[model samples]
Target chain A: MTRMIGAGRRAIAALLLLSLAACGAQPRSVPPPAFNSTDVMFLQMSLEYIRQGEQVLTTAQTRAKNAELKTLTAALQAQWAEEQGTMQRWLLGWSQPLTADPSSGAHEGHGDLHSLRPSDIAELQATKDNFDGTAEALLLGHLHNCVEVSRMESTGGQYPPAKALAEQMAATRQGQVQRLLKLQTGSTMGA
Target chain B: MRRRIALALLSIAAVVASMFVAIAPASAHGYISSPPSRQANCASGKVANCGDIVWEPQSVEAAKGSKLCNGGGSRFAVLNDASKGWPAASVGRTVTFNWVFTARHATATWEYFIGNTLLASFNDGGAQPGATKSHTVSMGSFTGRQTVLARWNVADTANAFYSCVDVTIS
Candidate 1:
């Protein structure tokens, strides 16, 4: 009986190993047409960008000196949050991994959070004056980056859903950029 | 004994399967190379102390209008500092901008800016760009040392990669 139990344990271990090996085996003999690394990179980066934008806008919503700036940040925060949800859903539906291996060196050339670094965020939080101006500048930079990346995905991305999302983002953000520029110049009366 | 052998074979198969999962996926993207953008210079070792950008020259990214050196990260912020004396490329009134792409994407436009003024704009529409493309841009009545901010805008996505070229107009 003791010997039989030991054998069963070994069998379980072996089964586990085999299952792992099976997973390692090519899931298909031929590669399926699906999301490649660029697609993945675009999706991942887009999500990150939106999340970062949300963070900055949230800060702006409360601290912005200008009522227009506060209103704009609140609207932007909602927009980005919705977009973030869409990206996450696509990532899930496509079965594409959400995060890239940072060590894999795959994320090298991709643009990331340049507009609002942690220090910049801290500074914005610390300063009671010129909060609106700083928020406007950061948000403008953020929107511009979004437009560029969305354009890339719309043109270059393989996945159709991602491409569509990119297109939508570009158009929406471009409009936002125009609005932001108007606000920056204190020309919010017409907008 | 037979069960043990079967188990051992299964383990081997699992190990092999795991190996396949461990393999990295193919990478594709685009970046400017000619006249060497800051990221390109760092990747090619033309610039020293480049930080993370040296590995992925194509990844110099940030908010579209953000005036950042290393795309936005502090690690590559050295590219943002103008006083670092980045080497300037000598060119005529019209110069060709070369783009190296790992994967082709639908393009919106290519914009070149000097300070707040736009120097050139090329409309690509939504056509998929080739792996390599060159555009001859008129420097637009500017002479002397100028920094050209070249932006490649993708049609579908909401971001653009930026490259700053230090050029001496002849």
Candidate 2:
């Protein structure tokens, strides 16, 4: 009887260990979202231009007489058209679209920064100072997004095509940063 | 007789061991229905008119000034953080939201705000800066559609973060 009891204890211990081992074999936690940093950079750049255009458009709206804003609007319209084309090409070639659908809603585009229509700019930047502040915010968001995207890409395996695109995006964003910085500093200094 | 005596001893040992098994009373954690109210669902970017916010919470803080048991608004705002919608409150109930943080005093604090209200206020707590904290007052009365606001104040100094979720009262 004593021998039987000892065997039963061993059997229970083995079963418990087996259960624990099985539990350990379960999969780990889920991975983060699939979006990479390259997408973030592109999204940020697109948003910057949108916001810049919106700022100019808003200035046009608040002023009793600002004809230059109209010209600015026209220029932005062309720029956005070009940008959309670029994004579409990338989307076509890259298996998926990086840009959000503008018609989806105000929150559709990257992080709730919606497309600024010609009409929206006038109302959005009615006050030059307010427009400037908003512009600054949008630019900051753009820069932050770029840095974030690059960080993600570094972690993602380096693919030549994706890396090249990231480089180009970084260059373009850098240029934008220069231009926006000048605009903001110029305005701040009252130059 | 010897075997009977051993069996009684074993039973007593088992009873004593069971008594030492520390059974603690279960704590009551508040629960909102698995899927929260949709009338003020802010995920879609479309504001729902009043008469939509409804949720069943198994347990909620009944403290006054709590923001957990409240919902209504012309524009309901739901923030999807990590893809989960922090459901809006409807038919206001008293709830107190508490956040605790520790920090040094007179230091530049970094903070984030969602709507117009100050959700977090940080103070340089001193050498051993204690926790910074804030809370929102959940309404006691539910009358009609009210504009729900999600506001945040990050750090020691910053503009309030603003977001809106509108819900209508029925």
Candidate 3:
């Protein structure tokens, strides 16, 4: 009985030691990149896209002839404003100064809204009869562009939180694009 | 008992290590480079007044089958504006499309078009692509000034990167 108890004690000691070693000797994986310029660019571009979308959607809410179009624009305006806030928080968390850094040249030449062109907007404003159709077409194009950028960020971005956000944004925008297509075709397809 | 514990801990550690190894690389997106797509030119400063595209040239993305120069996005709408007078590259009957990838991913296919006409296509079949890939294409009797649209479709994703290159064939 005495010998058996000693053996049991030794086994427990050995197990404890192994657990400690396991905790201590765990290999440290390579740290993620300190700052990825591309990620910075992506975040900046995403914010810009959101800003431009909000602007366009706000205008469409009033100018859109279709009731559905007005509702969609209002919903999108709220969503984009919330997303912009989230992106700004992420920028803060990443320790990136809100102001554009001239030395890094990260934010230079970065202000163009990619989805709706000036011509498209002008056409939408000019054509009062087919306002909803023009708005739908332009919004569909914008949503497609947003989806593409989000997809790239989810796959290529270094920041985990940003990547997750990008994934969610991609799904949401893709669904919106599909819904807009259905609306354009005059089909009440559920998203 | 000691051997069993050791084996279990070792198995756990091995699993952890494998998890770390499975993580993808940090950067993994790209665009067309051969004739210099509109975004590429903007990035390299060859094109002026390109707007946000000059900041991130790899992001000229949109839904597949869209003909918009800036990938159907207003932020990149400048690419669609012909008034910018984008310079055209002179090429021979045969030209290579070079794709520079910062981070490679499983690819679906690469298609090149000239004004709605399919010029050449390469099927990648969901295999992971390399950092840089070059595909030689025969211009196929089409000549003169043209805009070539190159589309890179990802196998696992619902999006594609589009590049519009202005080219003049001799």
Candidate 4:
């Protein structure tokens, strides 16, 4: 029995020593992280879309005939501006160029996900007196684009946080789309 | 004879339990790994004079909402020093930030900021993340050398993890 007790004591000491050494050892480095081209392109293009959509917001807020549309536009401005800032940081952190390389044929499989060009912005401004009509149409298209790019990111993004945000982005933009469609219906009836 | 055997067995069990207690880690949390935060740099031996943070990179945590790298706590306050000249990773306009956890904790949101402007935030919806997490952030129009403060806000607790990464965007 004495011998058995001695052996058990030795085993415990050895186990304790091993655990201590394991904790103290220089940590072996793990590979950084996994992020694919899709992750990169999605973020880049999303920023462009967000910036372009922002231009119409001030116009909508001041000029929309529909009260809900004007208030919703203001709310969207605050929310999307924050998102734009978030995407910008993600792009820089990944070490990719801030400006997206959409025209380079690199974003091949991703569907048409660009924001409204200057022409669209120009047209939006041209509808100055009746901004609600053009605002509804232009923003509806932008929100659809938001959902598209967000969908692409959700499906192809390997970065879990980015994917999680993409999912939330899709859901929010879809909700916004429904709201805009309702406002458009009401505006058309009033007109 | 039986009582002697019982006492010996009890002594052995007591010794083993004490060993296990000694081995158990205290407050194993997490810190940023990529673009290597200040604490991470200290742990990796990339920077010197890091104090206790060199051993416990994951414990640079304190209550939420402090702009300081150490969350305004005294234990890891060396991270708040601006003169350390920590090596800044040369990155483009966009970069992906990654993190490694010593022990996963329920997370609320991961936020990044430059100066007073919030660069980004990734919401976790009160979920326990894996051992690692990655966030792709755009620097936007921000250029030149900048120190970005990254934070991990815990879901259930009032505390959050803090890290600062210096970067020169070329």
Candidate 5:
């Protein structure tokens, strides 16, 4: 009995020491790595569409062609008006002209309303197309990431806005993938 | 043995709890770190610093000529951060007032007023060129929206210069 007690004590001491060692090791404390790269890609893609729309508006304004201007204006304006609501909610808690800065590098989620110059218009269009493609790619990528983020992880303690935004992006991007593909196809045929 | 188990579990729980608590505030939405530029003078042939003027009706509905604020006889406008009514209507209230005023003149003493009411008077003794002061009042005294007035009745008008007034009502 004495020998058994000594062995048990030794085992417990070893277990306790192991636990302490584990505790002492620095936790990797990883920041929830922001939404998967695809979410980021989609956001960037959305932002590009906004920029492209602006370029199209600027072109119409410069050309001063009434019919073309009206069509471009209506389409660009309609899309932007809808996006404004989304961006506002994403920026200010309630929307309505209030502007809040997203994190430093996370501005892929905001709108660009600053004035533009004629010289930069061409480059802006190119960027817009690039972004449009990227946004589509992100939509293609979202299904895999969404399952991992929503189903794999415990949502019990996730940040409300972050989680809500992820869900929104997931739904919106899927719809956008279909619409944007048609738009892209149409635009190519017209070109 | 049971006591030791409980203590060990308690320590582990405490560490995890503290770790989560420490990370939360950092993850909250970020805030604007700097204020917009402050206007130095309003009357230098410059259009009223479009950035400085703050009015609520924002549209045509700003209580139809409500007294926004008196800049002690200077020009004043609302600082975006200074607007009131959070978690409620931003421009729906019928009575809310706040003002920040700056003095452009040096003087021994000066009095500020808003329609028969004394807001703040200062005796600068030897105060500098641009003395600034702020006063706030609840609009419970006034009934309907009226053209609220503010003035800087200076002890020495020669030395007194004014900025602008920014007032918010409702």
Candidate 6:
């Protein structure tokens, strides 16, 4: 009977060992951070463009003559400000820097930077004539860039929450583009 | 009597240990849940006598190129059992399978198959996907009860996840 108890203890130890083996196979407890380069790049690019957009929206908010355009700018400022906060929080959680790396050349090249650029914001800031037209064009270009970054994130981003946000942003920006087109009467809004 | 008690105690300890192992974390895991795949049903208790897979429904992972529902993993081998007569969800010609992911991994391609015939495939071009993705697949002339095996090929890894949804198409 004593020997039988010894065998029982061995069986229990073996089971415990098996359980430990299974535990070893499990994903680590330190947290699984699965994010690709696209996820990081999208957040960085979006933050840069949205930061530039803040100034453009502020200009539109104060200087616009068109009533509907004023209302649109107000809406965009609030929405983008909230989205900016969200992206910043996510970037912090991912341990990514909020500022874009100028050395990466990701924001370089005419094709990549065509939609939103610092010069575009300056062009809007310095424009003395047709402020609304310049703002409209800049905002249109900014919106297009937002949609493009959103598409990139939705397709190539690994994080679920980030991808979900990207998809939502894409849909929202597309709708806003349509609205802006209706408000734009000049050739700049024709696209 | 003491021997019997010891044996019973050992069995109890084993059951408790197994239970603890079942709830461990699974990263980058996903499974199609709309039509209730074999593992989903097991997890939901809609089906019984299913081994191991009822614990981690999102972990039916194995190497790529397996035609089986569980991707040929022995841990989820019960999923490949055709004699279990898994329940089929009734759907239309254009059935959209909603893939509910616990964690979304970077993906290469999403493919669906009915037996030897390939139903449809979507190329992700080595991109990461969202938590819950949906694909609308046209069954075309195929009708009656069939098991649609969906495979997600991970871009970074050689492994892929498998989910077998039994659907009754009209």
Candidate 3 has an lDDT of: 0.63
TM-score for each of the candidates: 0.44, 0.30, 0.42, 0.44, 0.21, 0.43
Candidate 5 wrongly placed segments (more than 4 Å): A1-53, A56-80, A86-90, A93-120, A123-173, A183-191, B1-170
Least accurate stretch of 10 residues (summed lDDT) in model 5 chain A? A108-117
RMSD of each: 16.9, 24.8, 17.7, 24.2, 22.2, 21.3
Which stretches of model 3 miss by more than 4 angstroms? A1-191, B1-28
- Give the distance in Å from residue A111's predicted Cα in candidate 6 to where it truly belongs: 7.3
Instruction: Write candidate 6's Cα lDDT for A59-102 as tens digits.
Output: 78888877888988888888888888998998787556676444
Q: Distance (Å) between predicted and true CA of B3, model 3?
A: 43
Let me know the TM-score candidate 3 reaches against the reference structure. Answer: 0.42
lDDT of 3 by residue, A106-132 (tens): 222212223344544565667655455
Model 2 lDDT tens row, A1-191 = 99999999999999999988776665336422233333433443344445544454445445423243334344545655665565556545434434333343323322332223343334434444335434432333334334334334444423444555556555554444334333433333231
Query: Relative to the true structure, how large is the alpha-carbon lDDT of every model?
Result: 0.63, 0.35, 0.63, 0.70, 0.32, 0.70
lDDT per residue, candidate 2, B89-151, as tens digits? 343332222221111112333222223444344443322222212233444344455444333
Candidate 5 C-alpha lDDT tens digits along A91-172:
3331111211233222221122111223234533444333332222222222222222222122432335545654654444
Q: What TM-score is obtained for chain B in each of the predicted models?
A: 0.79, 0.26, 0.80, 0.87, 0.28, 0.82
Which scores better on TM-score, 4 or 5?
Answer: 4
Candidate 4 per-residue lDDT over residues B1-170, each given as its tens digit: 44467457544543443332233233546666556678767755667898867655667878899999888986877898888878887778887776654345668999999988899999999986642366888998899999999999999889898989888997
lDDT of 5 by residue, B17-83 (tens): 3332222111011000001011211111122433423211111111112333323223334322233
Runs of candidate 1 exceeding 4 Å displacement:
A1-33, A105-115, A187-191, B1-170
Binned by DockQ into CAPRI classes (incorrect, acceptable, medium, high), candidate 5 is incorrect
Q: How far off is each candidate at the interface, as Cα RMSD in Å? A: 13.9, 23.6, 16.0, 24.5, 22.9, 20.0
Error of 1 at A152 (Å): 0.6
